[model samples]
Target: MGDKTDPNTTKIIHPVYIVANIQNKVRILDGKKVTYSSWVKLFKLHACGYKVLSHIDGTTPPAKTDEDYESWSEIDAIVLQWIYGTLSDDLLTRVLEPDSIAYEAWTRIQNIFLNNKGSRAADLEHEFNNLTLRAMPSLEDYC
Candidate 1:
């Protein structure tokens, strides 16, 4: 075969695909913006397509001594990297925990955005103002 290969057939290449697809398709999830839901959905679909959804969805991992645990841990780390890479530095610092796994980090992020409706509302209002300002000639026309 040529240099081309199917990502699923090779574990080594799967991560490359995951990172590229995620970084390219998903925008950086800055807490200041109102893109969290769309970002989550896009990342989840890619993770599921690459068969690593368990890394972020609270799936139980095997014991440290288990043979499968080694591979599982490696994949989990990769998934964590994907999440962190797409996050803004401030938010990453807020959610980063000592020795935390992908699932824990994911849950913390979900809670931060989901429970904080005030922040979301503020962002939506900012977005609405910005959109109208750019789209219309003046405030009266926008209203």
Candidate 2:
């Protein structure tokens, strides 16, 4: 028999798929003009595609040598690109600087969104309190 490979049985290249389908699909956020509602929607969009975004999280295991620097640099560039690419120019100026780390940038955006208080928060709380399951549905739909 001639040597042949089955394309159907070949392993899928996940990184390519992640880059194309998940990473590229992330919408750029207008951080400067974002309202609470828009911020929440953008946050959910990012959360839904976090697997692609996780490359930017830089969670490699701790090491004692200088060998990891190259890898770390690559991760840092990816994370920084995502951070800068997603923010509006006005907000980008506020959140990032030459010395800022990726984690800090990510955390800053999250804190800005999460620290909401006042009328909007109260209104959302009221709606959440009144929410009920009306009919049979899948768990995702119920949620």
Candidate 3:
């Protein structure tokens, strides 16, 4: 679907509209503590390929035609590769054991990082309560 021909070469050139091969090495997630910063980096990495996790997870159905299916499968494979390559070894084991669709695997990763357990919630609450605004010479400095 993403091919072009140059007048000089008559050979098909695949446009790098989606993820570039070089970008495939963006950043590997360590899976120690899932933070928004890392999640955003990973999200942008996939977004560059137009491989939105929601769509891949079947929030939208697969195309009905064989050709469409082939295209979808190719994209899915790219996503699968990126996902597998980025996760840490421990996270990889968790992700692999489920034997799930790409979307589900992605979701599992998100859940591992994003889920707010009671302990975490309480810790945040404690931190919030203990926070204090230091005196500042100016309003701008306080801000």
Give the candidate number with the greatest TM-score. Answer: 1
Model 3 off-target regions past 4 Å? 1-25, 33-37, 49-58, 63-66, 97-99, 123-143
Q: Which stretches in model 1 have alpha-carbon errors above 4 Å? A: 1-21, 32-34, 118-143
Ranking by lDDT: 1, 3, 2
Candidate 3 is scored at a TM of: 0.56
| Consecutive 10-residue window with the lowest summed lDDT within model 3 | 13-22
Q: Give the Cα error of residue 74 in candidate 3, in Å.
A: 1.8
Give the whole-model CA lDDT for all candidates, comma-separated.
0.81, 0.58, 0.61
Q: Spell out the clash pairs found in candidate 1.
A: none
The order of the candidates by TM-score, greatest first, is: 1, 3, 2
On lDDT, the candidate that comes out on top is 1
Clashing pairs in 2: none
What is candidate 2's lDDT per residue for 26-63, written digit by digit as tens? Answer: 45667445564565466446643543344334454335
lDDT of 1 by residue, 1-143 (tens): 67987777844555534455467766789855737888898888878878888888878899998998978888888788888888999889988888888898899889988898898789889978678556889988778
What residue pairs clash in candidate 3, if any at all?
none
lDDT of 1: 0.81
Worst 10 residues of 2 by lDDT: 14-23
